[model samples]
Target: MYFTPALLAAVATVIGLATATPVPEPQGIAAGSIELCTGQYLQGRCTTITTPTGTCVEFPRGFHNDVSSVSGLEGWNCNLYHDDHCTSASYYVQGEQDTLPTDNFNSVICTPPP
Candidate 1:
């Protein structure tokens, strides 16, 4: 088969993209962050979020009413709220919480220990 210049360039581009090393995800826990999981006993789908000291952030998308366990608090005081925007019933969490009182918390605000 005869290869045209454009075809060769396109093949090269495709090859580069196919063989290029992908950017790896973070390996472990970073400072000022926590992990939440969907299963009790710290098993199953889990995601990490930056706590940003004393800021309130809602559980994004899938995590809403889905987190059954938590870990990596690292001395941060986390107040888990039952309503969005950190209102209504809330539960306090410090240190690694293998399981929450309930998995229905919709928002959380974590403050680093002084």
Candidate 2:
């Protein structure tokens, strides 16, 4: 196959636009992984979730009582973003996490080990 700079640029543009999501949506999601959650999973009351899997998980658009603090389980690490699409800066969280930088997040991205 042959490639061109113009072609690459076009592809990049398409991908960028396609990936852009509103602040209420998530950009990336992990699949089939061991994850742990306590004290609210998705705007609900304090609860725990294990071995969670999904295409993507997005928090509420604004503040929420449950969007704060997260800890991974069994070698699971995740990234928290302040934007809905995980496009903004990221806050990494792993085992025994109880607090976030902003006490709330817009998105969470996690992937299982290779």
What TM-score against the true fold does each predicted structure earn? 0.69, 0.48
Model 2 agreement with the true structure over 11-46: per-residue lDDT tens digits: 999999999586765745445332323244323233
lDDT of 1 by residue, 1-114 (tens): 899999999999999889968789976532377788999877889898887666777887888899898875677888889988887978988878888878998888888777
Error of 1 at 79 (Å): 0.6
TM-score of 2: 0.48
Highest TM-score: give the candidate number: 1
CA deviation > 4 Å runs, candidate 1: 1-31
Give candidate 2 regions above 4 Å deviation.
Answer: 1-44, 47-55, 60-66
Return model 2's CA RMSD, one decimal: 16.0
Per-prediction RMSD in angstroms?
10.1, 16.0
